[model samples]
Target chain A: MKILEDEKIVGLFFERNEKALRETEASCGALLRKTAKAILESDSDVEECLNDTLLSLWQNIPPAVPKSLRAYACKVIRNLAFKRLEYGLALKRSINSELPLDELEAVLFDLKTENEFSDVEFTLTLDSFLGSLSAESRAVFLKRYFFCDTVPQIAQDLCISESKVNSLLYRARKKLRSVYEKGAEL
Target chain B: MKKYRLSKALGEIDEVYIEEVLKYTEDAAAGKRRGIFGRKRIVTLALAAVFIAAGTTVTFAAACGGLQSISEHFTAYRTDIKGVGDTSSLPVIENAWSIGKTMDGEQDALAGSIKVTSAVCDRYSLYATIEFNAEGIDIPENIPDEELTFDIINAKSGIEGACRPVFVSREGDIFTYIIHFSESSSINGDEIFIEAHNFGRSCTVEIENIGRRLVFNSVEYCRIKFSIPVSDLLILDSVQSLNSEKIDGIIDMDAELSPFGFVVRYDESQVPAWEEAHSELLKQYGWEWFKYSTGTVYSLLSFKMKDGSTLENVHNLIATAESGSDPNSGKDTIHFSFIVPVDISQIESVTYLGAEFRFDAEAYD
Candidate 1:
């Protein structure tokens, strides 16, 4: 089967063709499924969440248009998967009790002092700090935090040693903390 | 900030930058970083990615576990025929082992007193009856359409805060809050904490002092903290399973029931004749009483209870497993669960679309 390009697939959605969903699945299925599987434990829950994600996209696409269909799909599926995981945890059914985002606490503004800093202001400051970093450094930071990828996974994906990934993360966190401290002082 | 706060912050990231990072990740994974994102795109992406990512913190307001005797004798079945009267039967409030505690508490900020007249629970949800009384303010019942912001936490289990209620209603001076959680929730435990926020405006309230005039700044926001002691809840155990007939040698039906809900499993690959018989059924079922999407079908499962009360299926969760040698050729094994308020043992036969799947009493043993 010939896979449609992202723009063409989006066009199909604009035309309200059900085939738009199929094409989207065909193009982005692996990415979405992989992202969901990383967080969710049950095969059934993962499949259901993915289907729900597609349905949600189909329902919302008339109002939402994304330049990158892949990113949009991944974000939506990831959220649905997280909700599924939370549901499983609520019922005491999750296989893995630990969340992928546990490590983020060290780098985040202290919850105790979270209200002391404004979100929009902090984001802008953090953005400036990231802009100052090299492309490689920025990628490493985002892969660890935003993507919720573990150090081992990041190392393997980046073809670097585990120690290198650790060092990169350490520097990223230190820089982020410094930037936050400065911003907080300001 | 809680994990959800972080998620909200991350949600504010620029869409263009998010796509750029996604593309960058894909390119790196594919070993093709020949064209890196330009400096301007990188700046935008960095700004977007700056939000701290924290794992969701499931916060509950309740403290610890202590089983207290429930002495109140409220009917477990809803009795206001005038309110939910349109239904075929009185909805059974499935709070197993409940003491029928009438909770009462009040917050000063609400400018009114509140009382939890009745509270109940099942494995899947928590239901409470609350009454708000403002001295000079005329409160409109069910003012907010979405849900009241609240978090129910089970101290025993580490499950995060609660979700919005599945149902909410207001009649006269009484407001009903029916908050739902996962079947896996520790709600069956003895103790659970509730942190709730009441958000509304007295726009509809007539200022009696002002001669029945609308109040502009009559915003009502109250944070209430409370807990409920639940004795026992019905879990899917000791269920009477029925031996359903195998259809087309490819699809097999498994049905089980209890007081809380019902489970239906339609397995396509158990027999493995697999010539699209089950698949075709899922597809061709079309938009009848049932709805199908690719590998799964959604339909109502209705059965009459022994009391002549009808319990219709409410789809809560679906579990699907796919099996085939090739990616495109697999059959999906689906388990559909419907949560209802009826006794499973009282059920005589299950009916769907004029077809009855009778339960064999002898085969159950």
Candidate 2:
């Protein structure tokens, strides 16, 4: 939040509270870049997303009067970058044709399976579901999903395991689906 | 250094959407200013135009359609010698096509090979009449061979150019040729003539000197030159699958390669050094096996949920739809699959998915 336009720490960017901007980028920029890079995979796209995040914070700080600067920057950058990726059609131009996900889709969400859950009224609940998880777990989940990093990549980042990363992801997905099903009375 | 890598990571990200949001805010501010005293409408419009233009370039490289071929043959592989002798049953192969290459290092040689071809010009002290292959030739997508392996080396003694394979395929017919006439420090040798099984198809075979005279002693080179006939050179293989319930997958070979004269970790007990080296070489097999496999291993994830879509789906979507490397599995497809549980809650809910995914990978020789 750019609440303090002159708060010495946030005063580096041309005397425009640069510290707040810097802190926002340092803290949230990492997460934001990881997410953008995962989806876009293009160096230019990821960098663009990061740059936009900083500029957005710079422009929005005065009037919006933010509270959590990191959160604000991340939210903005992530949405914008994701739009670029989606409309940009990154998914359509996949490099990993043998990606296990598509295979699972072939079986898991085949016409028959989707037909069963079509009217299941799945509200897609993640708020409490994630709130229950430890911060570390949430980070892993975010890194894995948000950034689409591999288990080893996440393990290297979190200093965990390729196996542990997989375990956590599996449990999280299964639990989330079950909980969502229950919420939807599926 | 890590910070630099991180910066490089963020250098190319986009923020157009963020710019749009700010533009909206700026617009609102400008509108309020204009409302005060019959302000200039042209001024506000110009300001908005400037804001939009500022964020317009949007030089974003969207990972989109880049599938080079329908069926891929990977040459990189990881080999294990202990089990290799037990060719009891083949590894379970799946929707994949793979090839393995290893440098001939048994005699402390670099990654070069010596096959006795018909073009053997023995008079010139040439062991094998070898001709180099062309640059890139179109190879068969569907073949019966399970796990193709090539003993490749940096041109060693008696070889000249890069004896690389140039595959160019049009429609169904394929034209493949191997040419070996260039190298870091070697010369092209006579061709071991071998009649082409398929007409108009010549197997280019060039040989490099056995002992590499690398310019810098510290930078010792490892050369591998394979001298097989055009027919033999074209080892059309697929991951052969055995029908068995024990393993619900296809059986493929794993090959490995290391720096010439590179030491192996486990060369003691019973497995010979060559055996160990052979096994390690299997890790990278033409990138075909890896490309098709679903793994949480290495650059791949075993399971992930993105907007209700599995990580596997997202990855394969990008991999299948686009061209050139997966974000996770830098090589073409899932190089190796490992299962690791990732917290899905951190990502957007099932409907609000991120690019995360998961799947399994199992390969055998």
Candidate 3:
């Protein structure tokens, strides 16, 4: 199927046209598959995840006119991939994903058991912290962690050295740790 | 805390971060052709997400540019900027496209209410669209464009400039004002104070002695003020000037790569033959009679990359050809500001109409 314009594809979905899914697959299938493969190893799970994502889009797009379909679809696929990972892990299955969560885990390791903040507060604090960063530094951090790209991948994409990417993450973590420590003191 | 708990917190950060990441990833995957206009919307959406994620109850409604000035320019290129597209997936020529902040709420004006709907700014210009609602007032058609005026004040830098409406339209109870300011006006600050006023007069054109004239009737003055906190914009401090070979000896084209956009400046008086040939056409096309100093050159120009790729999705092509002697060149000048940002290093040439002005790669230092 030929790739249709985003608005056209959305219109098709609203009109209940099955071609909307085909067009979406035509445009977004490769990216979704790549994102799923980054986290999930099994081909069968990846295929099932893609189907689940499409069903979710069909249900969601009627009420949600997503500004960027790519972002919306990718987020859905990423969430589904994470869910699949969790399911696999519950069965004691070893996963091959070296995701950015591993790196973020190190930064948040010092959160004391008696911290006063909830998850919502932590999320807000993180948003404010990211907002305080310079545009370049923020872009680098998001590329590495939020988008689940490797350090070398981010370095190459931004035309920077791998060491620079490491240093940026170091500074970001240091800043986050400082904020978290302060919150703990409060 | 357990490591798994930390992972959970990271995953729950918010949609704003997700949007930003997706923007970069999508842009990389798309190979960045789509244009800055699309990315600009994503930037706005992300801005709204930031506020919403911060627990603000303020809802974000995308207010695209309603400027005929900008819309007309983009129309020729087969792009409609009035609606959202996959702008976040586009790569910028330079980082000319920066995100803008939304206002906290609508500001009540003397006659009605006014709201600054959207703004896309760089060091060179702050392009803002203001929406005006005059509830009880019955606005008639054919209101003279000269009745309203906009003044912008940079709160932090204390710099101020006046803006003329590039585009203005009324739909029933609403009037949209689209305006811009050049770098000389100092648009670098992150927060701006806007004062929009309407002169107490109603005017119309009258044909007298084979000439058009503006006649005005006195009315009550109406004013509104708005305070907007914007984000940091790109500064074009490293501007480079390129003087191309003289065109037919009458004009020497000089171009500057500014953070706001690409500008091509030339002597307005050099092309008399061009003026004489296109005076009637220019008038019929709604160009100001007095400001028609330069010959009618093609206003719709194209910026080309090194690989012979044309920037087709660019917006805001503002051209000013007024009669003013240039202080440096001592000649009347015509200035063209194409809001499409370009990487000077990557740009191979600028094509205006059919004339190709190629840049010397070796001279770029």
Candidate 4:
């Protein structure tokens, strides 16, 4: 079927038309699955995460008219997948521990200090930091940290060398570290 | 903050940032015009030579035509690298040729054809554009871009490399894509094959006059062949030994410089000594010590040009590779590729780790 525009899909959600889920699946199901697969290892878990994403979209759309359904669905799927990943790790499952979270931890090492900031405040700081970056840097940062794309994958997708991806990540992480350092001083 | 908390906070970032990345990926995939809001188009003279072969017209466009476009396109996409992507800079492809060919038999099977519009190469990479035409096939509007995929293979060796196709544009029934091949080994061939596979998508097709909608999957596959003397492309073979002090146990340094970029490789043989040098900071930073140490090492590197200008703190190093993982093993080959394009012929010396490695007259031999 022809993919419906995101606005039309949102309108369907507002109307409580069940077809919205079908359209959503058709339009962004691949993206949602790809997002989940990036974080969750098991296909079953990925399927479950996709279902939860759809359910959340169904329950939340009337109150949340996202500008891009694809982006909104991705966030929901990623969060659900992360929850599954954490639960699996807690249960001592054989989940791989090679997530880029460790790298992110290193990048934000200054945040270990005792000062408390609301999630909103932290997110705002991150948004400002991202805003200060060049478009290429910002995209690479988000693709690696936010999208959980592998370095090789990012390199291939952007038509650059794998080392280039690593360098970009390193530079962005350094910049982020300085951002946190400046924030601590403030 | 904990990593999970930081990740959660990252999730809560404004959707605009997320959208920006998504749009960038889509544009990159499509080979859409790039640079500061996609407004910059660096122009160069592109010579196109057209001829007929086997009743089909084949075109051999000078590779220089697409080299600047490809370089500038990448430059715009990689603005984070200092001194790289300047349109005024010299073209990276010293001698270039772009060959375009049409699929011979695949058109009869699918009622459409795939074409290679342009292919070019530099010293280290190959860039090509492919166009898929579905003139007779009825594809639904707004189909997912992932429904289609393409691959590149070396015709001589029959070896295929991981090729990602970026969508360029769609006009009428033709879709354009651009692919890059970076493996120096795979790209040395004179002929290459491009395979396009449509994994089929559910599209609603209306009965001509009855207005009845029917959903069906459209799967198609085709392979197009093209030949270009990639080996004929200019190769700049300039490798110089880097001179550095014995302070940190890192030794035996060398650099390969080209108009595209420079790569520095060295052996970190005295791991214990290196760790001891930074032991105090390492203890203080814990898990972050490695990052700090590496960042400091990178900051100490600079390039001295023949024009007497210094490219200081060349922090835009784009790629790094290490062979040995065990820190206790005391033998690791560390490689760094700086993404900033520089005229290697104009370079005078490299200052790395507080010692200057000059490109003196004797060293050129």
Per residue, candidate 1 scores C-alpha lDDT tens digits across B129-237 of 4444444445455556323322222222211245433324444444444443333212333445555555443244555566676443323555655555543121323
Query: Candidate 2 regions off by >4 Å?
Result: A1-31, A62-68, A90-124, B1-365
Reference-based lDDT, each prediction: 0.49, 0.32, 0.55, 0.58
Q: Which candidate is the best by TM-score?
A: 4
lDDT tens digits, residues B1-365, model 2? 11111112222222322223233334334433433221111112243235335663211111001012211211111122122222112121211111111111122223222222111111111112222221233334453222112223233323222223323122222222222222111112222232211112222344476543322111112333233322112111112112111111222112111101000011011212223344444345422222223231233221222334333222211111111111121111112110111122222211101221221212122
Q: What is the DockQ of each candidate?
A: 0.09, 0.01, 0.10, 0.17
RMSD of 2: 27.3
Regarding TM-score, does 1 or 4 come out ahead? 4
TM-score, B chain alone, candidates in order: 0.42, 0.16, 0.46, 0.47
| Model 1 agreement with the true structure over A77-186: per-residue lDDT tens digits | 87787677667767888454444465555566463555566779756665677676655567777666666677788766754455555655666676676676667666
lDDT of 2 by residue, A73-182 (tens): 65666567656654555456543222222322222232332333322122123445555554445565555544456667665555444655565566566555555446
Q: How many backbone clashes does candidate 4 have?
A: 10
Kept native contacts, as fractions per model, are 0.21, 0.00, 0.27, 0.39
Give the Cα error of residue A51 in candidate 1, in Å.
Answer: 1.2
- Candidates' chain A TM-scores: 0.83, 0.65, 0.85, 0.94
Which candidate order results from sorting by lDDT in descending order? Answer: 4, 3, 1, 2
Docking class of 2: incorrect
What C-alpha root-mean-square deviation, in Å, does candidate 4 show against the real structure? 16.4
